[model samples]
Target chain A: MNPSNNNIETQDDIGTTGHEWDGITELNYPCPRWWVWIFLGTIVWAVGYWYIYPAWPVISGDSERGGTKGVMEWTQYKQLEESQSEIFSRRAENLEKLQNTSTKDVMDMPELYEFAVVGGKSAFKENCAQCHGSGGGGAKGYPNLNDDDWLWGGSLKELSKTIKYGIRSDHKNTRNSVMPPLAAVMGKDSVTKVSRYVAGLSKGSSSTAEGAKEYKQMCSACHGVNGEGNRIFGAPKLSDGIWLYGKGDEQQIESQIKSPQHGVMPAWIDRLGEDTIKQLVVYVYSLGGGE
Target chain B: MLEKHKKLEKNSILLLIFIIITISIGGLIEIVPLFRLETTIEPVKGIRPYTPLELAGQDVYIREGCYGCHSQQIRALRDEVERYGHYSLAAESMYDHPFQWGSKRTGPDLARVGGKYSDSWHVQHMINPQEYVPESIMPSYSHMATSKASLDDIGSHLEALRVTGVPYTDSMIENAYTDAMAQANEGEANTKDGLLKRYGKNTIVRDFDGKAGFVSELDAIISYLQVLGTMADLKDYNPDVVE
Candidate 1:
């Protein structure tokens, strides 16, 4: 059979190109007029989009940096800058208040406090919510924000300082402290005894006479005589049930004493500006545990 | 036009040739510009090659398909800039062999995740992501904490990266294994000092996995995560001044 024999004519006098298959003819219909028009319209739109946005690589000239910069000079960076400007304008008043007012004054002013809390909540979700929970409940190593138990003081001033400089961060003014690994210095037996004594403080369990002696000699300097902890040294109170690194169990306490995990919080002063940091301070304070 | 199309369609060889030419045009347009990649990437300060340990961690990250969920690219958007610090620059990922500019963000963008959380936080988060972020849908990688990272192939890995334009020196390649060990254990004074000298003064030398006496996969991963977007000096970066 001829290759073109399948091209056949139809009954309606709408001639097909002499093609047929099993008593049927294929209709060689013209492309839909609307569809063709829309296709052409899309091409036009694309050309317009290219003209208005960075498109096409440079072929010859050094002046053509990489791509053809559109007539409007629109870029993702420029778009971001414009949006940031708009946001800045909107928050100008609140930002100004945050910058000027003291940490105490921020809490006193209801409107400013509300503004800070709202802004800080979103900021915390973005910055601190990964390790510290969305609600600031905190994980094993991370400090819970909602509790009164603060390794550093819970006061607004202390929180502001902590947020600005961070704990053991690279920041110059970072709240630096190291709970030295006592297992090496105190020996395994003494470290275990101290761990037991520290754990028993919170539970009100009677510490072994040997453990009590070891606790006074090895742990008391920074952890305090009564195990109340010293905020100046960034030590957690042993008497408090709250443990930053682990749960207050025998194994957990022993592991912590043996090889202490020092938490490092990145400084927000460099990342988030002073105004935002102040707002964060107020927000953290409003988490219902601040002094 | 219909007659010309019919003629071309009838000749298989001619159609094949035309198809090859059409495909080549697209291929040339895409591949040719890569030759001028140096000019295309903006020159930026503080963008250094990854250390041996960080490189090992990056390998582990890829192995675990961390990029499947976490994006290394922070797009120049107001919200992204506000949340994830500065928008990610092309130069920031210049040394990345297979870039981690992921499309899907099941988790947050990890471009600026370095130094954001503590080492212990990272360790705990990796061991169990939900333990920290209650709402996080991320899977646990607790095995990494116990598993010992193989340092035997690190020197070769460095050499391979060097061949692919990572600027890993002969000295760096030679000391790659020792440097990986040193970076994880601060007690190794000689090797730790050597690591700092080779990499930089800013190289964080400590037991990353919280467990002493062993350098686990957890240490490498933590080291890698801790230095994600911290390499680039964004303080001096002027977004308005396009290089």
Candidate 2:
């Protein structure tokens, strides 16, 4: 490849052939030792790999042929499995601990939480990654697992209940909540009025004090007179910044109050298991909202 | 220019064939795997992956294309965390072998549906999905609960999963056998014995047989479901810790 090998000339630059063309010149820069080493290393490795693995062409070769099956017959899937086995073994230990220890204990212990987080990440990736994004970042309707805000409740028992029972799935224990629409009670404009009523609870600047008074009386029964929230009913805390439908768009809130929002989280008790649920709780709890 | 053009054309044709060959090979890899799956390892902590019967039920679920309407993933944002409790973690599905992070949400997400409902409700809902859900658009699976599902291959399914590496243990295997022999009504003892033996004697479950009692397949399904969000109450959930 080197025509210049014959003319071992030196350039002003550290490593190059001082070959000149017209006014411009070709500095025959032999690649760096590291560069050459890497290139040749790759070449040699490729050849070796080609021989050892299924790199050679086969018209209809299965995985064993023309693939990266090394001399040791190693493929990416096998490597992944090996690496995964290590993780699985580690998981076995954690699962063992989960079987013996209580979910509450798993929550309290930092080590268990750490274990829970690692397991949770893999499990989430496998089971919950699609809709939740890679790390439970959430989409339009889905809720995030990382935040402190909870729909059913954030406490261990509450979270467990939510996971086990789910929300509004046909499961017998499922939690059910509905806003019933202020429009149903009154009218759509009244929805805006009621939204203002709900808004008034946060800072007391709602346009309708009478509405707020009504809120303290009617809404307070479930939302708390202060408009905070009632966990039992899954009534979201009105004072909090995390709005499920949207932020405090007075119009939207008004519409929502007029109409209301109903979100559902399916019950899992019929799918996974109690221990798995507890592990999931620990995993979810470790996601940043447990305490 | 003509000679050069011919040479260029020749080279381009060669490149095109090579590219086509490469593309075909890549496509075939995916196609072939769809028919054959590797035996997966069950988590050594004693929880085996879903057995074929249970897996069949799940497949019945997947084929009925339940995922089209329901999503399985949960997010980790504030409201989601608040609503679903904590964000879903990664460890809950370590033994899934082929994890089921579903997409779409015409209905709700089912990442954690274990132990949430009584078995009879599941049966009733399957028979008449809309009876339980007044506004539901889901198809019914009542026949699945009522039919004499082929339980013969369940052992092979477990062994197949065992071949892959899911840890079923002696008792789990035993439970599978004993449960197989019992009348449908008497499956609870077998399920309990199996779970106790496999999970160990100390596992705490106040209502392991809530209402409908335990059927091994149902137990297996519920075991897979009951755990969704109950992991830990996070003091802090920093993503940086993952590396």
Candidate 3:
């Protein structure tokens, strides 16, 4: 059979392209009417969307007129602004109360105290939980908020002050102190004897005569005579079980005495603002550690 | 129209050519706007190029796949702004050859982490993330502290970055190794002064790893992490104006 003759006719009485393989004919069918209408509808919707949003770029390249400015004048930033404004307006009264009231007096009002605690809890999670544990259990150097040991006094007022200015931060009002590496100043052997004496001070064990003599000469100025610790110096009471840097072990104490790693807490005043700080102060004070 | 369609479908080479043209239209629409990228990024002050040490740290960050868990880009949302300070600007990542504007955030955003914590805190967090943050699922990178940072190839690294439109000066490229060493060991008067002279007075010159003498990978990575979103000063930017 001639290849040209195969395109002449088909067995079935239907429209065909005359393209057949092994006597199988092909029929050309139009697209479904509903599907075609829906497709057209989508194109119309797309065009309408283009007109209603920043869509097609213009040739001019000017940002203002670069793309089609919809009548809505909407942006992601604008949406965020609106939502934030709504939130601020809703909490305006409570926020004002939080700002005006003293951190210590905040606990007097039940509702305000609850609000502050809730706010502070979230703020703590975002800001404080990174260095301090999620439960405020404190890290190796970072202070534990749940313990009764006071590094820089655990009172609500003191907590507020510490949180505001921070300890050894760049903030001018920061609670500044320097625990000089005693090894450099008092010789290595004295530091060891002093470490042993300081470790024994909290454990109800009496220091050796040699250790006691060394402690008075080098450590009494900041740590106090009996290792009671001075708040002004930001020194910890050596008699307590709470060790800021490590587990109150002999080696850890010796290492600390050799080269003290002064813990630095950033002043949250610039970052978190006063109201949040007050709330954080109240929350931290309520954590069973406040003096 | 039917005959034309039938003829077009029958010709494979013609169909291929038409397909190419159709796809090219989409490709051009997507790619052409990048040619005018300068217009896209807002003008912001204090967005300087990364110092050699920070650049090396950034290389370490990329190598360790830190971007897999953390995102650098903070969207202009109320919650994000409240938590992560200001929203990230395109100008901040302008000098980055392949920017670290990651999408996922398994860990917190590192956009404004600089100056939030001290160098020792970063060192501790890097060595064992769970030590400070007990709930943290991040893996320990204790090995980074022990590993010494290779400073010999730092000059070449600066040259490579300079080729990708980073404004690294001839002197900066030449003194990249020393500058990195100086930034890590700020106690050394000569190197510290040299670093300040080359990188600018604002350069953070200190032992980032808390270990005074030796420069380690931990130091480089901590430097990079610390300076994540601190470069671009967004003080004058009024978000309301854009809105």
Best model per TM-score: 3
Residue A245 lDDT (model 3) = 77
lDDT of 1 by residue, B1-243 (tens): 767877888899999999999999999999987766665566568888888889889989999999999999999888788878888889999899899999999988999888788887788778777777777899999999999886779999989988889888999999998999999993356888888898888888878887888888999999999889988878787755555
Share of native interface contacts recovered by each model? 0.71, 0.00, 0.60
- Per-prediction DockQ scores? 0.58, 0.02, 0.51
Candidate no. 1 TM-score: 0.86
Best by DockQ: 1
User: What lDDT does each candidate get?
Assistant: 0.84, 0.57, 0.82
Is candidate 2 or 3 superior in DockQ? 3
Over 4 Å off, model 2: A1-90, A108-110, A129-133, A137-139, A203-210, B1-243
Docking class of 1: medium
Please give the C-alpha DockQ score of model 2.
Answer: 0.02
Q: Give the alpha carbon lDDT tens digit for every residue of A1-291 in model 3.
A: 577566434433558765666887677666899999999999999988887876765555345323555777676778888889998998889999888887777889999999999889988988888887788988788888898888889888788889999988877899999988878888878888888888888786874556888889888888889889989888888888888877787788899888887888888898788888888888888888987
lDDT of 2 at A5: 48
